[model samples]
Target: MNKKTQLGVPLSAQNRLFVPVLGASGGCGRSTTAGLLACFLAAVGSSVVLDTAPRLTSPWPSWPTEHGAGLASVPPGRPLTRHQAHAAASRSDGPAGKWSVLTDHQDWSHGPLDLPTDPAAWYQLAATGAWQAVVADTCHPVAHDIVAARTKGQRGLTAAWCALPFAVPVLCAPTSGTGVAALQTAVKAITAEGLPLQRMVVVLTATGEGRTPPVVKAAATMLESQVSAVLQMPFDPHIRVHGLSDADRLARQTVAVGSALVSAVLASAHHTWGDPLPPAPVPAVLSRTAVDSRSARPAHHEGVFT
Candidate 1:
C-alpha cells in the first residue's frame, strides 16, 4: 500500500479542495498566487500542494527558486501525455496526507484534450491512488480537456476517477469597461456547464493595492453575478525579486499575500454568497461585442493573442 495518513480518509476524502489559479490574463499574479498558497497551507500543517501546467503565457523554472521549495514547471506543448502526467503525480513526495503537486501540458486553443485521450493512462492512475488537493495552473481559453477532467470528471468514481476539483478562474480586474466586457465573455464559457457558479472564484489583480478605480468596482460587481466568489489582490511588490539570489525576499512576500487569498478560499469553501450574485448564465455577449459598442470602458491588456 502507498504511504497512508493517520485519518485513513483515502486520498479523495482528504483532498476536499482542488484550486485552479486563473487570471483574466497572464502576468496577473496567477503563478505567484498558486506558489504562495501552497507555502501557506504547508506552514499551517495542512499538507498543501500546487501543480502547474504547460502554458505559453508564463515560463516555468526548473524549481521554485524564488520561494525555496520544489515548485517546478512541467514540459509544455503536445509532449504532456496522460501517462506522463500520472507518473509524475505518483512520483512526487510530500507528507503522507498533507499535499501534492502535479502538472500537465494540454493546449487550450486546440479544444478539449481529455486526459484519457492524451495518454489514456492517467484515467486509471488517478483511480488507484495519488496526491491530495491537486492545484493545476491552467492555460488560457480555460475550457480545455485537462481543466474538464479537473472540474467535471465522471461522477460516482474515485477522486482520481471523478472530476470537480474546485475550479477557480483567476480574472484580472480591469480598469476599463472594455476589460469588464471581455471578462464577462470568459465567465460565460466557464459557467456554461451549469456546474454551480460557486465553483468559480475571480482573483482581481493590477489595482496596485490601496486605490481601486470606479471601473474596477464595476467589473467586480459584474463578475460577482456570474461566479461563487471574487477576490482582490494588488500587484505585490515581492514578485519583483525574481531569480535564485532573491529567494528569501520573494518567499516572504509570497507568504504574506498568499495567506490572505487562502483564508478567503477556506471561508468561501463552506459558505454561500456573501455579496449579491452576478447575472447568472451571462448572455452570449462578451468584449467582442463590447468592442463594437462605443462604451467608455476601461483599457486592459488581453493575454494570449490566440
Candidate 2:
C-alpha cells in the first residue's frame, strides 16, 4: 500500500495555476492534452501552454512574439511573459479561443535544446506571473526533473517539484495493462519521495473499442484511492488526426470530460492559490469538413485536455 492523505487535504497553491499534463512517454497523448486544456481555459479566461515534452510538439501555429525571442534566446532567470513567448506561441484560430503557447522551437540554436536544464530557470518561467492558467505537457515522468537538476550542476531543486507548489499534475495513463503498470510505478516512485498527492489527477486515456479493458478498468478503480480524482477520456479520432484544430466541434465531442476537468482544475486552483479567476468562454467557429467516415469522428477527448 502507498501512503496518501485524506482526499480533502489542502494542496498549497502557488502564484499561478499550472496544470501539467504528464505521462509515461511521448506517445501517451500528453501534448494533445496540454494544447486542448489551454484552449479550454482560454475559452473561460486567458491561458498559456508550456510544451516541454521531449519529443512531442504542438500542431498550433505560432503568433508574432515581442522582439522575436525564443525560450533559449531569452536570458535564463530573466523575467519572461506570455507576450515574450508569443513569437513561440501558436495563435488561437477563430472560434477555438485564444491562448498563448511556448513550445520547443525549429532552429537548433534558437529555442531550448531540451527541457529546462536548470531548475531555477524552470522556476523563473513558472513564476513569471502570466496567464490566468497554464497547461504544461511534460514528456518524462514527473520525477525525472529532479535528476535533470543534478546534471546541470544545480542542486536542491528539480523542475517537477519546483512547479509542484502551483501545479495540479494530470497523470495521463493509457487504457492498457502496461499503462496501469506504468502509473503504478510512477505513483510508487513519487510516493517514496513523499511528494504530496492531494493535488494529482489520474487521467486514463482510452482507445475507442468495443469495451474498456478489464485490467484498465481495474487499474483506474485502484488509482482512485491514490490521488485526488481519476478521469476517463475516451478516444476521439479527430484529435488523433487533427489535434485540436476545430475547437467548437471538439468541445461538443468532449463536453463531459471537459466539464469534469474544468471543475477539478477550478477546485484545485481554489485550494492551492485562493480565488483564481474562472476560465472564460471563447466562441469557436465551427467547420463542416472536420467530420469524416471514421468511427472516432470529430471529438475533443476532453479529459486529455480540459
Candidate 3:
C-alpha cells in the first residue's frame, strides 16, 4: 500500500453503533440492504460504513487504487491516530465526514478472506467516538462465524441479526401455504442455533419487482409473530452499483422503508446502551416511535458490550 498524501483527524462522533447485515445466500440483498441502510444512516446523522462483502471489488463504491487503509486492514490492538483512522475511511468524492466507507483491503487473496473481523478491534474503534454507526455488509456460512466471534463471552452486545440466515424460501414457494411454511421452517433453523430470535429482523427483497406477491406478504406476517421485526425492501429500478444515489428522486414508499430500518437499528442501539441516541434526523414515522417495543434489554447475555 502506498502512503496517503493527506491524512487528517477523524471526525468527532457523538455516539457509535455496529450493524452487521447478513443473509443465507448471495442474492438475498444483504449487501444492497447494508449499503443503502448505511447511506441512509449517514444522511440522517454521522456514520461509517464498513464493506466486508466477499467480492473481487466492493459492490458498493470503489475506493481509489491508491487509497488509504481499509478498516479491516487495521492491525489488532494497534490504535489508529485520528488522522490515520480518517485516511482509513473515505466517501465517494474523497475523505470527508461521517458518511464514508472502510472497504476491505485488496490483499485478502493471500490472507484470511473468509474470517469475520475481530470484535475487540471493532469495540476499540467504536470506543474512539469517530463514528455513530458501523454498518457491515456480510454473507452467510461465514456470517455465523462472525456473529459467534463477536458475541462470544460478550453479553448484551446490542448487535442485531442474531442467526438471521435471511433465507428466502418463501419467495420461491409455489403457494401461500408453502411460502408460510417455508418461512417458519427457516425461523426454526435459526433458533436451533441458539441465537436469540428477538434480536433478529428479517428483511425480504425482490428481483425485477414492482410489488411483492401476496404470498410473500403472508409469509412476512407469519414471521412477524416469531421475530422482533419483519421488513420488505422497496423495489427501486434506479438502484445502482456506485451507491444509494442522492442525486435522483426516490419514491416516498422507498423512503419509508429506509426510515423503518433506521428506527429498528436505533431501537437495538438503545436496548444495548440503555441511553437515548444522540440528536439525529429521523423519518416522520420514526419521529413518533422508534420501534414496536423498547427492545427488551439484552436477552442473550448480561451486561452490554459497548
Top TM-score model? 2
lDDT of each: 0.41, 0.55, 0.49
Which of the predicted structures, 2 or 3, would earn the higher TM-score when compared with the native? 2
lDDT of 2 by residue, 1-306 (tens): 111121122222223466867675435666666766666565454577765644234443332122133344433323333344444445554233566666555553444354564333443353443355667665555545444544575442323443544667777778777777877776765675555566777777765645788998888787777777888777877666666655555645465676566567667667665664333222121122322221222222110010
Candidate closer to the true structure by lDDT (higher is better), 1 or 3: 3
Tens digits of per-residue lDDT for model 3, 1-306: 111211111212444555666554445666667655655565444666566555464554453223556655554333344465666665642122225666666554645444344444443443342565566665443334434645684422222233212111111122234444544554554565555556556677665555677877877777677665777776666654333534134456666776577666555555544445443221111111222342432211111111
Candidate 3 Cα misplacement greater than 4 A, ranges: 1-14, 55-57, 61-77, 92-98, 105-116, 142-186, 240-251, 271-306
Compute each candidate's TM-score over C-alphas: 0.53, 0.69, 0.62
How many residue pairs collide in each prediction?
Answer: 17, 13, 1
Instruction: Report how far off residue 111 is in candidate 2 (Å).
Output: 9.0
| Deviation from truth (RMSD, Å), model 3 | 12.8
